[model samples]
Target: MKIKRSAATIIGEVSALILTFLTHWVVFYFIIINSFKTRAEAARLSLAFPKKWQIIENYSYILSYGDGLFFRSMWNSIRLTIISIVILVLVASMTGYIMQRRQGKFSKISNKLILAGLIVPPSVISTYWILSQLGVVGTLAGLTLVEVATMFPFSVMIYKGYMATIPRDIDAAAIIDGCSASRLYFQIIFPILKPITATIVILRSVVVYNDFANPLYYMSGARNSTIQLFVYTFQSAFLTQWNYLFAAIVLISLPPFILYLILNKRILEGVTAGAVKG
Candidate 1:
């Protein structure tokens, strides 16, 4: 059956798109335009296009700043994002699979804990203290672990929801063929989970890559900085160079934006599938 949309519904949808454009696209345009301005001109922070473009100079300065600290920070952010995503995918997927397949006291307790994780805001002080005790504070490994922990609960929920949609009969069949539990999951179930995995990867990759607060809290020092933290180098008490700051922002924002553009469809599909299935 086909349904006809009301005029009001069409108008509402169009209005939402216009609003989104004004809020997001307009802001992006403002940032891009300002990034090309002189330090004094950028300080004005107006939507007007730059009268004098310092395109190459601004970007080059940002790239070559602090003996190429920006590049090092970029590498650090990338490494953290990749490591976190890999661990989250493997651990969360298996945990979700087990939680879905097994129903018992342990599963119940775990579900409650995950629920709590979603609701509870983690204490930065406590987390830092714990990391300090573990002797991992200010290290990439510690930061990676924190990133994975932060993302784990939601990832597991998505995996568990999607896992429920997969028939248990498949597991029975695989087992009947002498597939071990680990083999069945890795070879069969894991491959089938690519869609959700892609969704998780793109979404979480952006979060981890763009994360400023966690990195600031857990990982200190210039050498340990992530791309987001590299922005601080542009500011000081005496003066702030808005042009260089905006330019750096533009450069750092590109990777995640490009990634989203490439895999945007998977995000909606995965979320919707998990929602409907679970």
Candidate 2:
């Protein structure tokens, strides 16, 4: 009876997993299917093969010749993601270290502030206040600042958790060896933080890369659009020409997609290490 029950449970779990895989396959299949056609095919034969099979033409049209602003969006997204994620990782590392190591009233308050920032949606009060003050409405710098502020808490929490597992003895030893705080971290603790750092890097990059609302609010011009914002406009505008839109999507999605694909192993390792150690 116990053996039968165990088998039943295993079968149920397998069935659920299979269902999830099928769903994912269907979604990706449609996305790929749309990328190889013109607007006519996308509208008329969404589920069928392309009329001309002009995958290159579809791709190039969006990129170079088509009525699309894909390349500009691609550049904007890449630049914003790289800059924002790098700053978040570095600043969050230092802030996380201090928050954990200091252990004072102020540190506790600061930690709570970060958590509050995370808990409250950025769209609520902060946007109103920031826009009212900094006059950063619809500017790249404003958007970058907001992104950093909103994303910092997650990185800090991850870093702090990972740092907790690291021995204070290491810090003491480094300090006794005449290592300054900056040198100690940059040399000793920083190296050990590789896994969580990679995890944060990939995670934050993905978030910033995929962001739409923030860009929509803060970025306007076709010349100044990020990938997500650009894709959004194209989707809204092109009711008929979906092939070019899909191709634009495919291009815009390549960077973060490629970055995660290449760094996936490191990202997993970092997350696993942080989890187990924390």
Candidate 3:
């Protein structure tokens, strides 16, 4: 039996939706409104729209810095995100499977260590010390390693949860068929892990792509700057050009944000699955 919608319920639902829409758009409005004005015009009022749209001018100014390093920084971010995600998937999948399937006292201790990484603040001092000792400061490899170490625990935890959900029968079947562990994982199990993989890709790619602090401490020089570090530099320049800054900010943030909108459902499922199994 279908129940008819009440007028009060419909009104309340519409009101709630309107409130949500306005709340979401208010900041968007601020940025989009300011993104059009000249520096003088943008500062005229906190909430004012541009009297004339200088969007192109602002973009030109932001992009004109140092022969267009903005594009190069984007390239760096893409490379870092891809490499880090691939490494995390491969290493974490195998490690999580082992830890979950081969449960033992030592595995429990190892699990605790991984959890410690999550609970504790990343040890800047220890990282700096390691960098100093290895003489790898200000290098791309150094920055990459730092990112992997800092981000590894989250991926491991997620993968461990997922490994729990995968049946041990799959492993046993592959073994009975004379398949090696590595072959079984990559050819069979890895394929089955796609849903969680999508989740990891969306979630971790955004984070590693957007992380600024790690790059600030580790990748200081211009030669190896990721997009996040590059964006920070744009923000802190002497002039504080609001229009150009917002334009660059929008450009910097567009890719990951677009990706989120597209794959948000899958990402949500991955997170939910991880939480449920974990």
Please give the distance, in angstroms, between residue 100's alpha carbon in candidate 3 and its true position after superposition: 1.3
lDDT of 1 by residue, 210-277 (tens): 89999999998889989999998788898899999999999999888888888887787777777766
Encode model 2's per-residue lDDT on 242-272: one tens digit a residue: 7776777777777877888888888877776
Model 3 misplaced stretches (Cα beyond 4 Å): 1-23
Best by lDDT: 1
lDDT string, candidate 3, 1-278, tens digits: 99999999999999999998788877777877787888887765377767788988888876877677887888888888888888888888778778888878989998999999899998787898899789988776677788788878888888889878888898999999999978998899888778888898888888888888887887766768788777666456465667766777778878988878888878776777766665
Q: Is candidate 1 or 2 superior in TM-score? A: 1
- Scored against the true structure, residue 96 in model 1 reaches a CA lDDT of 95
- TM-score: model 3 vs. ground truth: 0.89
Per-candidate Cα lDDT values, in order, are 0.92, 0.80, 0.81
Q: Determine the backbone clash count of candidate 1.
A: 0
Which residue pairs in candidate 1 collide?
A: none
Clashes of 3: 0
RMSD values, in order shown? 1.6, 3.1, 2.6
